[model samples]
Target: MTMSTKRPFTKDIILLDNVEEVTNKIIQKLQQDVLHNLKRLGAVVGTSGGIDSSVCLALTAKAFGPEKVLGIIMPEKDSNQDSEMLAKELAATFKVRTIKEDITSALAGFRCYERRDDAVRRVFPEYDPMTYKMKIGIKQTGLSNNLPPVFSLTIIDNKGNQEDKILPVKEYLAIVAASNFKQRSRMSMLYFHAEALHYAVVGTPNKHEQEQGFFVKYGDGGADVMPIGNLYKTQVYQLAKYLGVPKGIIERTPTTDTYSAEQTQEEFFFQLPYGLMDIYWYGFENGYSAEEVAGVMEESTDQVKALFSNFERKKRTTDYLRMSPVRDYYGS
Candidate 1:
């Protein structure tokens, strides 16, 4: 098999020039958002051993000396052990102050797993929570997949066996509620440190996740400043390389890091890989026809249109997540 080269459509989105200049602008923005807007001494970033957070942390450290930034590792029982270790490793390399807050017990009061499991048992009666992990996903219909994805639940047994079944609406709601607690819990921890140190909480989402509504509202979505939110995932990687982020982090795959069953961002939300998805979103935003983009990306027109349709579907479904809580007409 032969490897594919960069596609022409990348010109519409990927920023290939003046990476240093762009990096400087983001650095200034982070400083301005924290020191000026929030009047905070520094910024607090929850590092997940992923490139987005790693790059965000590096930028924050550069903006306000490494001593000022705080890196918090908030892992729970389902969190990957390597994530915590890598987060610490990134902190040490950047010379940023670090702290660990295991939130498994704190989230216990929420009955996260129990409620989720209760719903799971409705289908898989013999599913043992202790010995297995569960993940929810959508069934991809076809290239021209105009219809909404059929959501399904998947369970992985300890012996590495796997099972997939259609998810009831109640089960989907329960699982999502339980998983979201993890993000909200981490956000709470970050605020605790930020409040204590008079620092701003820095969000790590890239343009794709930010614009596509991929983040959980009032959870990972809550932040004083999103340092990398304006950059596409590919551009974020460009900065990552330019900023000398840890090689391990720069190369690690982007994951939801939300579920115990191990799922990628593409699997959970975006159907395409971040690199490809970024350009597609850009193309869609700029009003490029799917057939036009398909020709450049070497994909079938139907596939490109399908992805575009899916993007629109997600945006509509998640629009509510982007809103502030409702109040009285007087803005109470």
Candidate 2:
């Protein structure tokens, strides 16, 4: 019953100290693994015109050749065309086949689930959409132990101090819900493509997010093998440049573009830029205590500890990352 005090970020944080070498190693290894693991395999990538996907596309194309890599771009109705454009550009740049799938139809279906009839049934059902929707707009802050100081990150770096301005949390969640659904839908498409081609779904999430457990369960984190899961954001940029990722894709502030993410990805993490974050988080990922990690980074002690303590949440993310259907266990 005792609460565990270990900082979560240290447990599974992928080290990116030697990013160029790490990325090359991961990409080469995965390519070889997939080549040997499955027959007639062709890799599939979901390209959102984001930095992560661009890097993945470039590397996958290089390793497997353009004919063997497919890029799928999933755009929600509200999403800007820029994302789609970037995905297509990267696909062309890498000479990969491109598919565009709009997810507005699916979101409508997921939202339209009816709760018809019986009052008792309407009142309670374990799998009700209403119940799941209730997960939205609730006072569920601090649910995860990671305590990433997301607010502090925002307020600290935002020059105008606009981070404290009241944000529509409910609306934000709804928007994110729709956007995440689009991601999951696109991922489903990616997996199906992989299945047809007998190839692996190449994962693009990097090391820092893995440590912070920053992904939806059975969602974005799932992949056959994460080619860039070992790289840090700081390092990913360099590799992107090395691999010839377009300047626009590399320079555009990192964002899920979920819920109109005006703030860059770093801003959401309390304005802690990746370069600055990597310096200390690198330590945490390498088993340095929060105090020790913070000490070198010159960040406040409590905030840094909060980031480290997110171990349980990180563990859950790792579960999702490692989880998949067991073909052997199913007696195929």
Best by TM-score: 1
Residue lDDT tens for model 1, 20-125: 9988988887778789988999989999999899999999999999999999998888887889888988898889988889998888888877777888888798
Weakest lDDT window of 10 consecutive positions for candidate 1: 4-13
Please give the lDDT score for candidate 2. Answer: 0.63
Give per-model CA RMSD.
5.0, 9.0
For residue 166, give model 2's deviation from the true position in Å. 7.8
All candidates' TM-scores? 0.93, 0.69
Give the per-residue lDDT of model 2 (tens digit) for 192-273.
Answer: 8788877888877887766666665456787777777877787788788888888889888787564322445654432456
Pick the lDDT winner.
1
Evaluated at residue 256, the lDDT of candidate 1 is 78
Q: lDDT per prediction?
A: 0.84, 0.63
For model 1, how big is the CA root-mean-square deviation? 5.0
Q: What local lDDT score does residue 260 receive in model 1, on the 0 to 100 scale?
A: 79
